[model samples]
Target chain A: MKKTALLIIAVLGILLLRAAEDLPFWGDPQSPASVHLSDYYLEESYEETSVPNIVTSVLADYRGYDTMFETVVIFCAGITVLIVLRRTHRRRAKVISPRPERPGADIILQTAARLLVPMMQLFALYVVAHGHHSPGGGFQGGVILGSSLILLALSYDIQMALHRFKEKLVLLFSAGGVLLYAAIGLACLFLGRNFLAYGAWAALLGISEPEAHSHGMLGVEIGVAITVLCIMFSLYIDLASGGDLDEGL
Target chain B: MEDLLAYIISRYNYWAAIILLLIGLYGMIAKNNLLKKVIGMTIFQAAIILFYVSIGDKRGATIPILAHGHDGAHQAVEAAAYANPLPHVLMLTAIVVGVSTLGVALAILQKIYRVHGTIEEDEILETIDQ
Candidate 1:
C-alpha cells in the first residue's frame, strides 16, 4: 500500500511539473496573474479607499463579502470543534491519563509571561489598527493576540487562562465579531446603499467616500481580529484539555 | 543543456512547491498514525500558500503597499512597481481557514482516540471490523 501510494504521488508530481512548463516564469511582472485584475487593484486601491496597503484594501474593502464569509467559516470551525470534543459529563472511563501535575507554576515562566503578554497584546492592537499603512492586519494581528493567551496557558495552566477569559466569553466574542461585521453591512444597507457599500456611510459619518471606505475597512478588520482572537484561544483550550476544559498542556 | 538549466533555475520556486506537495501527499496517504496525517495536511497547505504568494511576486518590485512622499504628496502609482496584492489577499483567507480546519481536524482526532483507544488508522479499522 505504501509503495503504491508513493508511485501515485510520483506520477502526480511529474504531471504537476509538466503543467508548470506552461506557467509564467517566477516573478514575471507581465504574467497573467499580475496583469489582469492585480494591476487595477494596485493602481486604484489607494485612490479608491485611501488605504496605502493594497492587500488590506483589497481584502477588507473590495472583497468585503468574501471576508465576511471567511470569518463565518472560522467561527463555524471553532463551534464544530467544540461540539465534537467537549464533554459536559464524564461518565465513561478516561481514555487518556490525566496530565501529571507540576509541583507549582515556575516563577521565571510566570514572570516572563506577565511581562510579555501585555507587550504582545499591545503590538497586536497596533498591527490591527495600523494595517492600512503597514504590513500588519486583522488576521495576523488576531493570531498574535490569540498566541499571547496560548502562551499564558502554556506557562501556567488552562484553568488559569480560562479563569481570565471564560469559555462563555470566548464564545460570545467569537459570535459578536461576526455580528459586528454583518451589522456594518446592514448599516450600509439602511443608509441607501448596497450591502457592505462603505460609500453609503460617508453621509452618516460626515466623511468623504474614500475616508468612509477606510473606516469601514478598519471596522471590519477589527471584527475579524476579535473573532480570530477568541476562536484561536478557544480552540487551544478545548484541544489541549481534550475538550474537558480542565488542565491543559 | 544550458538552456534547460536556466529554465529550471528560473522556475525553482514552483519546483520547490511541487516537491513539498508530493511529500505532503505521500505522508497523508501512507502514514498510519492519524496525527502524522494531520501534520502532512498542514505541510500540504503551506506548500499551496507558498505557491500562491510566489505567483504574486515581481522581479524588481517592492511590496504591495504604496509608497508615499514624506510631504504626503501622492505620486502616480505604477502597476509594474509593486508585486500583485490579489494572491496575497486570497492566501490570507486560505491561511486562516487552514488553521481553523486544523483545529477541527485535531479535535475530531482526539474524539476518535477517546472512543477507539488508539490513533493508528489500522488499529481503528481492525476494531471497527470486530
Candidate 2:
C-alpha cells in the first residue's frame, strides 16, 4: 500500500512539474499575476482608499466581503473546536494521562513572562494600528497577541491564563469580532449605499470618502484581530487540556 | 542544455514548491499515524502558500507599500515598481484558514483518541471492524 501511494505521488509530482513549466518565471514583472488587476490595485488603491499599503487596501476594502467571510470561517472553526473537544462532565475513564502537578510556578519563567507579555501586547497593538503603512496587519498582530496569552499559559498554567481571559469571554470575543465586521457593512447599508461601501460612511462621519475607507478598513482589521486573538488562545487551551480545561501542557 | 539550465534556474521557486508539495503528499498518504497526517497537511498548506507568495515577486520592485506616505496618491505611481499585493493579501487569509483547520483537525483527533485509545489509522480501523 505504501509503495503504491509512493508511486502515485511520484507520478503526480511529475505531472505538477510539467504543468508548472507553463507558469510565469520567478520575479517576472510582466507575468500575468503582475498585470491584470494588480496594476490597477497598485496605482489606484492609495487614491481610492487613502491607505498606502496596497495589500491592506485591497484586502480590507476592495475584497471586504471575502475578508468578512474569512472571519466567519475562523469563528466557525473556533466554535467547532469548542463543540468537538469541550466536555462539561468529567469522563469516568481518562484516556489521556493526568496532568502532573508542579510544586509551584517557576519564579524565573513567571517574571520573564510578566516582563515580556506587556511588551508583546503593546507591539501587537502597534502592528494592528500601523498596518496601513507597514508590513504588519491584523492577522499577524492577532497571532502575536494570542501567543502572549499562550506564553502566560506556558509559564504559569492554564488556570492562570483562564483567570486572565475567561472561557466565556473568549467565545464572546470570537463571535463579536464577526459581528463587528458585519455590523459595519449593515451600517453602510442603512446609510443609503451598498453593503460595505465606505463612501457612505464619509457622510455619516463627516470625513472625506477616502479617509472613511481608511477608517472602515481599520475597523474591520480590528475585528479580524479580535477574532483571531481569541480563537487562537481558545484553541490552545482546549487542545492542551484535552477538553477538560483543568491543566495544560 | 544551457537553455534548459537557465530555465530551471529562473523557475527554481516553482520546483522547490513542487518538491515540498510532494513530500507533504507522501507523508499524508504513507503515514499510519493521525498526528503525522495532520503535520503533513500543514506542510502541504505551507507549500501552496509559498507558491502563491512567490508568484507576487518582481525582480526590480519594492514591497507593495507606497514610498511617499499618503502623498503617494498624487504622484504617478509606476505599477511595475512594486511587487503584486493581491497574492500576498490572499495568502494572509489562507494562512489564517490553515491554522484554523489545523486546530479543528487536532481537536477531532483528540476526540478520536479518547474514544479509540489509539491514533494509528490501521489500528483504529481494526477496532472499528471488530
Ten-residue stretch with the least lDDT total in model 1 chain A: A89-98
How much does each candidate deviate at the interface, measured as C-alpha RMSD after superposition?
Answer: 1.0, 1.1
Which CAPRI level is candidate 1? high
Residues A112-181, model 1: lDDT tens digits = 9999999999999999999999998899999999999999999999989999999999999999999999
- Candidate 2: give the clashing pairs: none
**Looking at model 2 chain A, which ten-residue stretch has the lowest summed lDDT?**
A89-98
Error of 1 at B7 (Å): 2.0
How well is each residue in A1-249 modelled by candidate 2, as lDDT tens digits? Answer: 799889988899989989998999899998998889999999888778888889899999999999999989988999999999998655635455546666776899899999999999999999999999998878889899999999999898899999999999999998998899899999999999999998899988899999999999999889999999999999999999888887887
What DockQ does each prediction reach against the true complex? 0.85, 0.83
Stretches > 4 Å off in candidate 2: A92-104, B1-5, B70-73
Candidate 2 accuracy as lDDT: 0.91
Our tally of clashes for model 2 stands at 0
Residue B59 of model 2, lDDT score: 91
lDDT for each of the candidates? Answer: 0.92, 0.91
